[model samples]
Target chain A: MKMKQALLTLTATAGLLAALPAAAQFQKPEDAVKYRKAAFTVMATHFSRIGAMAQGRASFDGAAAAANAEIVADLAKLPFAGFVEGTSGTEKGSPKANVWSERAKFDAGAKKMQDEVAKLAVAAKANNLDQLKAAFGSAAQTCKACHDDFRNP
Target chain B: MKMKQALLTLTATAGLLAALPAAAQFQKPEDAVKYRKAAFTVMATHFSRIGAMAQGRASFDGAAAAANAEIVADLAKLPFAGFVEGTSGTEKGSPKANVWSERAKFDAGAKKMQDEVAKLAVAAKANNLDQLKAAFGSAAQTCKACHDDFRNP
Candidate 1:
């Protein structure tokens, strides 16, 4: 728990620099858009697998659930790396300008989501279905909340 | 190198069992398709970042390149977990039936690509541009070759 807290702090600190796109990393703003979208896609991929289990759409196999949750947690830190100012205002599934203008709230939302996903991973590791369900619900709420305010759709 | 050798042998061995879809891991074949596509998408995301630097389309920031390459190496092992017989037909980016019909060649291709990516990671960590280029080129070729034979593109 202490280690997760420390890592969360570090991720929050990294978020400070996140608003500024690393010029050397992307040749254009669209590349940043692509980067963030790709990260989100991966997040969706793993999350969907876990969600299916949670919803009873799929069997709850302990090992697969744990592995998927682990990936979701690790991937939680990646999309924010692409949330630069240049990426907003594009029509191609890019964020609206409010994401940057309301950066604090946006960042808080991101951090909360990350924390929730981390919890999901812990729950998955514990092999406690109840805990995993609660954590997954919390994580999903954070996702919906963030998207409601920050995303295009 | 010993560890890499061990992983490659293990991965190659696992390939022997790849044609059998793990019903425990995926309840539906589409889930497997989605999973592997997501893995490939993530791999492409990170690999392209390094590819840009290797091809001179982006700056060669040593630290970023190394970080990306390391992720690429890790992600290299993921997509195969999705390539099962259940996913070998139809579209939506699933493998062509030839992928299963020629499973041996496909697995060999997969192994070779993973090995080349591992080499790229080493080159990136060394911050040697020439080595990175060579390894990146080789890895890219492996990707194209595999797709040409196994994928519908």
Candidate 2:
């Protein structure tokens, strides 16, 4: 009976591990921090380009908007994998500890942002400024929501 | 005749601009530098994961290798655009001035790396360890060649 219980426990542990995101292994915790920041930086740069067009800060070039949106969508799936344990910071603008403590909510936020960004990509390709603006607004809200909830002020 | 010369000059300038890589605009030179560095950091992290598997330091996982390779290939197209004017540094490991001065050669090097990385992505999907290693070797060589020539010692 003890052996059977051990087997069942092992199976459960394996299932949990499989259920976790495919987090990339890091040589050090600092490496994970750097990677996540880098991913966010690149994603933000492209996303901001779309924001510029959406807000009329820059002229709306449909091709440029679509390209930037595609990049933003591709990158939306990356940074969360780097939110490894014990990597949170107390500094202003850093990821808060609750990212791990409230893992489910954090993940849900990430999924929400990714979904909105994907829609933004589709809207951008339509070559309509109004469609791009609407999608960008939705995606931007997802970003703000996650930041407000998960990041340090 | 002078009017015709002005028009010809304008056309040639447009052709030159068109021949250049599709670089993403940045608000400042520092922003361009940061963007490129972020891109390289992310690409390097993913590439190192495949390197670990290729070198037998990590157990080979075909799906993980393929995923990393795809990220690397996508990123290989990015950093070159950030090599904007006035961003070179004198520090060791910084991009050298020749990256701009020797523009044709630098662009060629970027193209070579991108091509090799694309092949690496395909090889990684083959689920054959030998093929992955071979492709990784070629891709690594391209990276090394660029670093040796265009990066400061």
Tens digits of per-residue lDDT for model 2, A1-153: 653564345344333333434454887889988998998999999999999999999899999898988788767767877898988999998999999999999988887787788778778888999999999999999999999999998
**Per-residue error at B72 for model 1, in Å?**
1.3
Off by over 4 Å in 1: A1-24, A84-94, B1-38, B81-96, B151-153
- lDDT per residue as tens, model 1, A103-144: 899989988888888778777877777777887899999999
lDDT string for model 2 (B111-140, tens) is: 999999999999999999999999999999
Once superposed on the true structure, which residue ranges of model 2 sit more than 4 Å away at CA?
A: A1-24, B1-12, B19-24
- Clashing pairs in model 1, backbone N/Cα/C closer than 3 A: none
Q: For model 1, how does the per-residue alpha-carbon lDDT over B1-153 read when each residue is reduced to its tens digit?
A: 999999999998886565343544566777666767767876887899888888998877776777778778877877776776656766645589987788789889999999999998988988888878888999999999998888875
DockQ of each: 0.30, 0.52
**Evaluated with TM-score, which candidate comes out highest?**
2
